[model samples]
Target: MEKYLPYAVLFLRIALALTILAFVADKMGYLTQAGTAPILWGDWDIYTKQLQAILPFIPGNISEKLAIVATLLEIILALMLLFGVKVRWAAIGTGIYALLVAIVAGYGVGINAILHYSLLVISAASFLLACCPIYKFTLHGIKKRSTYHPY
Candidate 1:
């Protein structure tokens, strides 16, 4: 288990990075149609409407902007995780983002969409665990610092 720790962390990082990159590309209108539409497994319009309904505090334009920001943030977080730079903060941020995605997709949409979100959640969790003190490989593992230290 100890010997494979670094490899495991690398694998999780790669997976999360790829997943987030794909989402960012899709949101940037490079994957499909060129628009500010929300990407959904089913009907985009219906999903957007549901999102608006769920998050009524966000105005229409602001919600679209938020989606784009979220995608960009995911891409950045994924890259940071992959490079093992600020691993602890990046992992925690990604984990929270994954949980939000899971909640929105699972309840707002359908179970099928939840699959990918759940995978993200698991990957984020793995990275988070790898950053923990008990993990065999991490920046923390090398430096042996307390959790309060900002890397």
Candidate 2:
């Protein structure tokens, strides 16, 4: 188990990053018309609508703006994790973001939707990554240890 810790962290990192990117893609319309998917919003319009539905207290204008902000944050977080930049901090941020998402989304969609979307799992994985002491396969590690000369 100890020997596999790094691998597990690596797996979580990639999974979280890709999952975030997928949602971002869906919001951007890339995954529009995805076939019978469990939890995709399809495009910005649908995403905004879903956000409004989830938090009906918020005005529609504010909800649309919130959706945009959320998408931007997801993109930044995903890129940071994918590139291994500030991994631990990013993981913490990811954990917090995912947790908030779970709580808010769960409020509207219920336990089943939260479980189906794996938001809690994503949060847990991110927190696990933050607790890990070392990451052996980051871009920084590759750059520092590489013997290749570009000169």
Candidate 3:
């Protein structure tokens, strides 16, 4: 198990990044058409409506802007995780964002529904990655190894 720690962390990082990017893709209508079942939001308008539904505290006017900001942030965080840039901070950010979403969404959809969505699991995985000392499978790892001076 010890020998696989780095691999596990790498898997976690990639999984989180891909999961986030998938949702971003859905919101952007890169995945499915509107009125599609199972997929959350097909386009920005539907995405904004869903956001408003889940987080009703956000004013209708602000929900659209918030959805845009959330989508952009998710893209940035996903890329950061994928490239292993500041992994700890990125993981922490993802964890916090997921946790907040889970909490709010739980209120809207109930615990069982939120659990099915796996937001809490995502948050936990992100926090788990943040706790790692280093990620040995990242681009930074490769670069550092390539630049090593074995004097």
Candidate 4:
């Protein structure tokens, strides 16, 4: 059981990576389902409407910019996790980002979605995996032993 722990962590890392990527794809329109326009609106376009609906104090353009930046951050974080470049920090950032989204948008949705989307949980999972990276199948793992000597 102890020996397979790395594999388990790797599996969790990959799962979180894929999960984040799926959301990115949805935002990028590679996986938008029909009739979701009423709810999801499919992409960064939802940023304006959602921000306005939840926090009307923010300007429309600022909300749009936030959406774009958030999307980019998600993309970067996903890539880092997928490639195992900086899994720990990426996971932490992912968690923080997801928590913000959960706080702002999670409230407006149904209990099921709030739970299902589970960004906050995703955040925790990613961060946990970061603490014990397998690195057996990752590019970063191959280059050299990670020098992440946290103080």
lDDT of 3 by residue, 41-130 (tens): 789888788789988888998988888888899999999999888788899999999998889788887898678879989999999889
- What digit string (tens of lDDT, one per residue) describes model 1 on residues 27-132? 4445566443445323344445556776777899887777657757887897886666676677778777777777766666567767744655665564574465
Indicate which candidate wins on lDDT: 3
Give per-residue lDDT, candidate 3, residue 143.
Answer: 82
For model 4, how does the per-residue alpha-carbon lDDT over 10-119 read when each residue is reduced to its tens digit?
Answer: 78778888888888777666676534743344655554576567766778878788777877888899888788777777878888787777776666654565576787
Q: Candidate 1 vs candidate 3: which has greater lDDT?
A: 3
What's each prediction's TM-score?
0.65, 0.87, 0.88, 0.81
Off by over 4 Å in 4: 34-39, 107-112, 145-151
Once fitted onto the true fold, the runs of candidate 2 whose alpha carbons sit more than 4 angstroms away are: 1-3, 146-151
Candidate 4: the clashing residue pairs are none
Q: Residue 139: error of model 2 in Å?
A: 3.0
Residue 39, model 4, lDDT: 32
> Which pairs clash (backbone N, Cα, C closer than 3 Å) in model 2?
none
- Which candidate, 1 or 4, has the higher TM-score? 4
- Evaluate model 3: give its TM-score: 0.88
